[model samples]
Target: MDGQVNRVPDGGFGWVIVAAVAIINMTNQSILSVFGQLFGGELRRMNEDTFTAALITNLNSLALNFSGLFIGPAIKSFKPRNVAICGCLFVSLGLLICSMATESWHFIVGYSFFVGFGLGLISPSTFMAINSYFSSKRGRAVGVSLAGAGVGQVFMPHVVRYFLDNYDFQIAVLAMAMVSLTGIFGAMFLKPLNPPLQHNNRKHIRLLSEKDVEKCQVTPQAETVHQPSEESFSKKMLSRLVQALDLELLKDFVFWSIIVGMALVYTATINFTMIFPSFLRHSVDLNSQLVATCMSVVAFADIICRLLLPCLTDYLRIPYRVVFLLGTLGLFVARMFLAETKDLRVIIAMSVLTGMMKSATVINNNLTISSHCRSEKLAGGLGLSMMSKGLIVITVGQLLGWIRDYFDSYVICLYAQSVILFLVVIVWSPEIYYRYRRQKRTTTKSIETTIEAGVEEVAKLNA
Candidate 1:
């Protein structure tokens, strides 16, 4: 196995990993999506202000993404399976703590920090597993895995609402804790591939072989080499640390563009979803039932797109970046329509479009990064992308709220989000075009050169 080249199965057990990841995603997202339903009444009864509630939510997101800074090292040290299992335990424990909490700060400590950090671990581990297992079908596999989130979003609310209706808050939270434990079973399936999919592992083998050869050549009486100075040793250690973290990815223009574009699209789309109900009820003067219907439509549409869009794109052989760009542009158009319309039917249509476009963006977020990174560096790329997203969300997320407060309008917020999407489209559109043209020109020149060489060889044979 050490001498053999690493090759992705692209099927078989890879599909099992996909299923396991999907279940993990479903379990994690079910708990996360229903946070409001689980804790909203309790927080209100405790006399917590909306600002405090918002802070709790923001803290959760902050912890989830900021923790990415450590995930690469964690996965490298402990392996994905162990990391995922530990994450499951952390989430379960956090929920147990949340069930017993009596204060806002308690909820913050239990739910926001603990559960958020757990999710941070589980997410990237599962993602890395999927990327390791498949190559040709990666787009479809990612879509299928992330569809679990949509499934949780669509159905978990009813399940949580049932518990909230039948039992006390603590009992419902306790039930959720038990539900979280199922992810441990899923995590157990994350076995490392034999021979592994990483080139670095093969490189290490070659290095060891070279050392063996050197040992064979050296004489028994050779003097031992002196150790390096402390300063040089420290510099070497620092360089290794930087390489492990893949900090060099930050120096790449393409990588930077991908992370920034994803961060902006994610910030805009997610924040919009968060405030969509408010927009519908207050700005559109929609009734409660209609608002609920709109939300349901969005969820259904989102899940359907998640299940189908990536598969369709892969079958069509469209580049992930191109699909991502189209999604962003579609989002910009959808938001513009949504902001301009007051009709219920038009709003519903826009909601569907928003869901579909958002699904495209979500499916391709990591796909784009994986396309750019080698197998070994994938973990670092994903971690850094998450870190960037966390920073942007923490800062710009606050600004979105401020824009709403300053204008006293959700409509203005919608416009701001559209502008964000437009900016991403502007940044990426020209780059994608330029790259396509350059590749085409290179191909054309190669074909012309080959033809001229063939003609010259035939003429020499005739002579």
Candidate 2:
């Protein structure tokens, strides 16, 4: 596309967007996604229905995942900042309304729908914007950007813990509303970019017969920024969606292997933070501040992982596929240690290690998709992966909640989770090697083609 600013500014406003978006995302993500863990006490107070209380989280998650489908194309259509601003409005209002809800359904329909709707605005566009704004530093920038979620993981629990302990759930909801509004304003700074998405349609010109590039002479103009009209994707979009997702992905042994591996391990690991707080409240006789402090420790650990792991990947000479398999090993140790739980020190260690390992999971999966797919469609492919991962998290959330309630011991769920993580670790090993070899071969062939092309040019000159 024309008029794209793909390079990161040396040291000016681009860095500012990173900080601003980070705060906005941290606040917004905490407000919407982690409500289950944070507001457990509040939801129970209002509804006396853990299931319905949880529905608020579940529905929000479903909407968050579903919105990815629409948000991708929207990136090309609307300016990134506009999409972000719209999302902020949806979430800020959702939180404010939740403070007034008298019933579970009110919270669900209002809080979940609107908040999910808002986050939908923010989530998909966040990475795409950073990718546009920052060129050389994308992985680090994205790592830093998405690390906002872990930042939320670090503080929001304690924030929720504080309000629940002191004032009431309404105050907590209202405070988070204020936090969400920050994102609304932050979205103002996002100047959209036309990223260099390589068009593969040359071989499929028949599919896009409406436009003739050779005759058209694409004039560098502002019109390029406008999104296509309402019916833009109306023709064959369903097929394109299917083809883009490429469920044949599931058929490929590596794809299925990676999906199952990521899903099971991630599903098991997602709930440790939520459950750990309750476990502390139950086992240790600790006050809310102590619990929040401990949670903060885990959050800091997550921040370290987010920062360190990306640097590790970049400098690491090994194939990332192998690194991903090795990385999941951290989860196994973390889970098993938590299950033992003979002492508080062990508990803390397990929590920190889990945070570190989960951060690796985030980086590895992005690496996985980046390696497999073409650059242009990577975002959409990633969206589909998120859709699957989100669904897995929802099921795991409910299951973890059930396990916590049923066994009355967080360790049991922790142990069960360890088993799943390890199973995935074992399953992913061979597949990781397969992908490593495939990419290696592909690289070798591309190098050979370049060498041959140069040789042919030399031969023709000699003739």
Candidate 3:
């Protein structure tokens, strides 16, 4: 026990890591929201159709999500702080380059490709840093860190709108690039609990003493530990790369289930935000100011719910899966009502409800996924989910655009979202129920066996 390292500090420097990651997320979300709001105006400026503009935004999202695929390797090979710094630079460079763009293709290449990749690099690193520091209050830390998006959402529209109104698009973009540079400062502080291990194919199995059993469990932290290489250069490098990708996760059914379910949840919640400003303008004929106001309402509501719901869940001892399901149900109801509402007030109310559901779901998403696997598998599971979500975005992007383009109604788009959400819930709910029942039965049998074994031991001692 003398030389053993305590795994998680649970507080102290961990909260500092949380703050730094929160700032990174806040800036990233702000940039994303600004781009979403600018889609229509930029399309008009470039003389491009809505479909083309939507494709670009979807691609941007796809890049951002897909970047997670590389994060596992990046973190393994580089320090989290170094990777984060590189990510911030990529984001800043992307935005700066986009300011010089004169064509639709330029925007796609600059904003979608560069910025999205930068985001992909930063996203996992943020959560991983938080995870390194906090174990006991991880749920709370996740909620607080992600709430940065809400904070960004609350004010970023007005800031971006002011810049768009007062200056040319190029100047506005330039200002955003300048704003993004601050993220580098945040990234600088993202020190991990310890230097993560270099990637190795060998597994670590610690033989715990009976007294230490309650204090520590088997973990994949060796994924974080680095040792001197003992193999040929090419073979060692190849093994590290393979270890970083963690491709073996593809065999997991539970992992697939969580990813598919998350894809559906994302399609219903965050994806809607990317396209909602266009919906308000096209369907309801709302002015830019009003549209921004509605978006802000959603942001404000999301912040409030995110701040409160996680704490409440902890106090009430609610299961993460149950809360996540309830959140999805709320999102479905909100979307259904949103499709039918004509009044601005009703739409705004539904937006607020949507935000609350999104917040609740986001808070629990990581927990739900991690529950399905060992601690070491968490990074791989998240990467797989991100890759799956990106693929789903590519397919769904066209459908969403077609609904708006051919149908000429945002209501249809909202309806499409509600249906997708409903179907996912229907399909996944049975799995959750069956798994719950099986776990409960297994637990009961274990208890019975333990009791019988205890009785036999007592009889032997008396004899």
What's the TM-score of each model vs. the native?
Answer: 0.90, 0.75, 0.82
Model 2 ranges off by over 4 Å: 1-14, 32-47, 133-136, 152-172, 195-237, 240-260, 280-293, 317-324, 363-367, 394-409, 438-463
lDDT values, one for every candidate: 0.85, 0.67, 0.76
Q: Count the backbone clashes (under 3 Å) in each candidate.
A: 0, 0, 5
Clashing pairs in 3: 196-224, 197-224, 197-225, 197-226, 198-226
TM-score: the better of candidates 1 and 2: 1
Task: Provide the global lDDT of candidate 1 against the true structure.
Answer: 0.85
Candidate 1 vs candidate 2, lDDT winner:
1
What's the true lDDT of residue 70 in model 2?
60
Ranking by lDDT: 1, 3, 2
Q: Report the lDDT tens digits of candidate 1 across residue range 1-463.
A: 0121248777788888888988888888567789888999999999998888888888888888887888876777667888899888888989999999999999999899999889988988888778777776888898999998788777778878888999899998998888888999999998877544443433544564565456556555552443334565557556656766888888889889999889989889768978999999999999999999999898888889988998899889888889999999999999999899999989999999988998899899888888778766778888898898899899887899899999999999999999999999999999999999998999999999999999999999999
Best by lDDT: 1
Q: Candidate 2 or 3, higher lDDT?
A: 3
